[model samples]
Target: MEVNLIVETLKFLVLGMSTVFMFLALMVVVLELQAKIIMKYFPPPKENSLVSNSTQELFQKGNFSVVAAIAASIRSYKKKSK
Candidate 1:
């Protein structure tokens, strides 16, 4: 009967969706646990003050070569498109 078919289809849809949802939930939990374990065993290195100061100094000294290159590329691309 059509009614029986509809009910069966609905049941199948619910089962499939539930299985997918449960799988994703389990994956998230496992990944979080793995990250915690790795962090505990081998933690990230602390940043040194000397390295931080040097990075700041580099920024303070305007580094314009990178900016110039990007602008040149954009200009070349615009010319090519036209």
Candidate 2:
């Protein structure tokens, strides 16, 4: 019957969605656990003040133009890929 078909279609859709949701949830938990393990084992290196670029001046106009070109190419590439 039509009613049975609709109910079956809904059941299939629910099952597919639930499977995807559970998979994504599991991936999140696994990735979080991996991050914690890695961080605990290998701590990040300390940044020395002498070699830091924190107080550097802003980029020049030519550098800004180059960066804009790179950004445009990256955007176009991403659009093509998608």
lDDT of 2: 0.74
Candidate 1, residue 45: Cα displacement in angstroms equals 1.9
Displacement of the residue 77 alpha carbon in candidate 2, Å: 49
Q: Which RMSD does model 1 reach against the true structure? A: 12.6
Q: Residue 33 of model 2: what lDDT?
A: 97
Candidate 1 lDDT for residue 18: 99
TM per prediction: 0.53, 0.53
Write model 1 residue lDDT over 1-82, tens digit each, in one string.
3579888899999999999999999999999999999899988776533443343455565646655665688899999999
Tens-digit lDDT track for model 2 on 26-71? 9999999999998999977765434432222213323565566667
Off by over 4 Å in 1: 1-3, 54-82
Q: Lowest lDDT 10-mer window, candidate 2?
A: 52-61
CA lDDT, every prediction? 0.77, 0.74
